[model samples]
Target: MKPVISRSFLDRLFAAQDYDGLVQLSSFFQGTSTCRLEKADYGLPRPFFLIVESLVWFAQADRSGVWTYFEATSAPRQQAMLEALTAGAPAGFAQAYAKGVSGWRDEAGMAGLDRWLSARDDENNRWLWQLARANRAQIDELLS
Candidate 1:
């Protein structure tokens, strides 16, 4: 069974900007295993985006850590998780997984995000992309 992650832990890590802790937590998502989220304890009622944003921040903080985690996970498993997370996500959360995994540009997985975005024409998707673009500098600064 996969390890269960409490929303309180996520809240503490994110609030403290604990990139190392976030990377360590992501290791639980490796391989074909799924990590369970304790949704009720989350800072926000809907915690999916909160988790995704933290993952994205961690990926930005340490590209090698993100690459290592992805390398250990199968493509199909990764794709399934991506689809599930983005399916009915709110505006900025639409491309969360894509933005997180796209850090590994040398891999074919990056192309999937481009394709996914290309196929979408919704306002939320557009706003998500724009928000990502606008926050690029801030994201980089956080990493620095």
Candidate 2:
């Protein structure tokens, strides 16, 4: 199956990290079904599912949106995690799986995501964290 979204698209979206852009992009993803479909794809890391999930949350409110943008843009570790996941996963399962299996270092990615989202000082970061949490929960459910 074709991947629903592009890594560059996500990278740009994350890089933009603006409330207006996030809402626009989130709406686009919601309309296109990119985030939901991508989450369902078995080949990608569950953490990414969380990233997008939090995006939806971030898109919901004007103030929260600002926080969302601030957190994503300011947090280098989170960005690095996203970058690593992006490099490994890119835009498709075919690529993501190949890189994932060849020692793609998913644990660090997950840990980074977990730390960023779970931190209490980051009310701004919670939306993304929730998304990540949801993704992990889904994967855990599947594994269990």
Tell me the spans in candidate 1 whose CA falls farther than 4 Å from its real position: 1-65, 90-96, 99-144
Task: Tell me the TM-score of model 1.
Answer: 0.30
CA lDDT, every model vs. true structure: 0.42, 0.39
- In angstroms, the error of model 2 at 44 is 17
Q: Which stretches of candidate 2 lie above 4 Å from their native place?
A: 1-4, 33-144
Tens-place lDDT digits, model 2, residues 25-106? 4344344323344233312344543344344323422333223333333243334344544543324422322232332244
| TM-scores for candidates 1 onward, in order | 0.30, 0.25
RMSD of 1: 12.0
How much lDDT does candidate 2 score?
0.39
- Candidate with maximal lDDT: 1
